[model samples]
Target: MVLEDPSNPLVLRNYAQYLESKRDFSGAEEFYFRATQADPNDGEILSRYAKLVWELHGDQTRASGYFERAAKAAPEDSNVLAAYANFLWEIDANEEEEHSSNAQVDENAVLVDLPAKDFKEEKRPSSPPLHLAMGLGIGRMDLVGINQDYIISCPDDRTTLEEYYKRVVDENPCNPLFLRNYAHFLHQSKGDLHGAEEYYSRAILADPSDGQALSLYADIVWQRHHDKDRAVVYFERAAQATPETVFIPFGFSNVLASYAKFLWEVEDEEDAIEEAKNRMPVGQGTATAANA
Candidate 1:
């Protein structure tokens, strides 16, 4: 069918899904790419391609580009918005884990020190890496590792990462993924709570159903702004927006847990607390209460 009607994006996408189920990832990738080229506005195809890239190849940066495109192509698609939000959460979790691991390095561990004469200074490259060029060609300035490479290549330059993030947000202003990431970078790395809050608000404005952004924004409101009422509103919205599915069980569970905790501890709203508890999975309510 695909060969007979080579321009049929649905057929191409179906074939890609079939190939993916058969574990023919390379062939599936080809078909998926073809499907996207055939119908660039198909958010479903773009989301599927993004998931395949992330799951099969573990290429977060490339998957992010596809997901961003998917969200842009279909701003009103709930499934696509949920998937993109989940991807951003996964990226945040991985980055936090990496930071935690780095922080755990033994302070007392002895390091072998080489003589000064044993080391030679290496010349820095005149331009960004090849991956950066490819990313630029594809209008993906937010490829994670390429931007990190540019920053690492010039350790003395602290603004490289911020500049790239600014450019990405500028180019994709309404993209929740970019806005959320920029907000996170500002809050965590730059210590700019005001900027983070602004971007987080923009992200939520772009996609009010983005549970991750809603949850994180709630945290900022609670911790930084000390606006308990507003924070509760955001947390409740996050809980309502987050769907309980195998793909995003953690996100849903976390939102529910946080909401419950806030209701119980912060607002001391017993009725609301019980409501939130009932929404949680069995045993999660007990654990959340204990943690609270």
Candidate 2:
């Protein structure tokens, strides 16, 4: 029987989002599946559910399906277009590494992203291709403004990342994302803590929900200015706004543990213990969390 209520889909979507935020992947997937079943024809539902499956289980086929559905649903959404393209690139890299045992393109090739125009109906492959330089292009472009968590951060890639981020910022100064992430890159890679602080301040002004930026900025201020009280405020804010990614709780716990150690070393055993206790019973996930 067809359900007549549109709110049904909305409730399922929100519940799924909550579970995902809580890092309950299986539970989230279950609800997403329910959402998909309840609204099979909904492009958003298909796309979202497909995304959840891939995100939770690393199921490429399923992920691709949903991403495709999402793209189809929102043909004009650059975000969806870019995400799907990047996924294609990942698929290619996996296959290449699996077969060739090495991907040292050295001078033989420069990465090239095949724009969507290249994927005409007659030329579609039996499966997704093993290369889509376009995906890296998409990542380079789309991720430039995004504030990735500390865990996924690859500081060594700062130069190229910075170039892209600068380009993005130049194109859209109002987009505080690139500026904020650039600040993180500076702090982490170049030790330009002051520069990072300025950028972070700007980002916070631009968007209150930029918790990663705010939290990291707080860490910098606390460590740089030796303001533990202020740092704790940021940490608490981050923990509050933080999503249930694979790394957030772990990141929070690690920082807390480090703060505790620092306090203990300084003979502030009370605060040290307090900090340690704060992160204890770490939410869930990761090897460290399991040990805790």
Candidate 3:
């Protein structure tokens, strides 16, 4: 019935989503392509299609074009900006030698492997990396990661990660997502647990329900601060927030898994660990939980 109106982009998109849910990638792509053709300027549709193609088919060339079109169509849309920025960042991060040097990278320079003009002719083998599929979705975190502050201070630039994060947090001092992501970045990249805690606390204050921030807060305090009481508080709070969260990506799940490991492995609370494992979606079981 939905396909009866082949010209209706909304129906097509919804049908595409249905097909996607059924694991029918070919059918989903067909409907999504039709929807995009009917409404070429729809940034949201373009973004969805871009992600769909990239994740299912590993067609980075097509995905990049769709992302570019989406950004051009809606230049001010935060979601579009976030996804595009993530795409660029992932491309850079995948490159082996991009960030090896201490010397400043030129402001005028761009990633040579991902030249804008060369995307049209790019090709790939049949088998794509499993990691790419595992890390497909873009969440609020991705949007937060692509702040102009992060972009302007390219990895090649002398501006330190701390400096870049400071600029972003300063730009929107009240934004919880920015604070949360910066905290994660600092913890992961700089190993600055103390600095991360400050930002994570600010993030929680700004929006107490952010499970990602709360989870990370629990992680650092438990791991580094050795504050079991404080850590448990945040962990419980994060678990409470999980059901209401939009989605929990693998990275977020990994953090939770770490906390769960701490409970079962480090803290030796098997009952609480089981409860934590049950909170996550099916298939995200805590079987892989390991020390950080």
* CA lDDT, every model vs. true structure: 0.73, 0.58, 0.66
Highest lDDT against the true fold, candidate: 1
- What value does the lDDT take at residue 259 in candidate 1? 58
lDDT digits (tens) for residues 1-292 of candidate 1 = 9989989999999999999889999999999999999999999899999988998888988998998788668754556766776676677677778989988855444234534334322223244333222222222334433334244456575446667677768887998877887787788777889998999999999999989789889988887977888997898788668774424423764665555455545535556777888898999978876999
Ranking by lDDT: 1, 3, 2
Kindly give the stretch of ten consecutive residues in candidate 1 with the minimal lDDT sum.
131-140
The better-scoring model by lDDT among 1 and 2 is 1
The list of candidate 3 runs beyond 4 A from truth reads 1-161, 244-252, 268-292
Q: Each model's TM-score?
A: 0.40, 0.35, 0.40
Please estimate how well model 2 matches the true structure, expressed as its whole-model Cα lDDT: 0.58
| Candidate 3 lDDT, 17-128, residue by residue in tens | 9999999998898889999999999887898899888878777788889987986686445566566556544544444244566555765664655676454223221221
Question: Global CA lDDT of candidate 3, please?
Answer: 0.66
Clashes per model (N, Cα, C within 3 A): 0, 3, 1
Candidate 3 positional error at 275, Å: 26
Distance (Å) between predicted and true CA of 221, model 1? 17
Tens-place lDDT digits, model 2, residues 1-292: 1145544867787788898899988888888778877666666667667776766688987787787666556543434444554555556556756767665555433335544455333242222111111122222232322232211123343434446555555665655566666676677666888988987887777777656666777777776887767766775565455442223222433433333333343346556767876777755335565698
Error of 2 at 247 (Å): 6.3
lDDT at residue 133 of model 2 (Cα atoms): 13
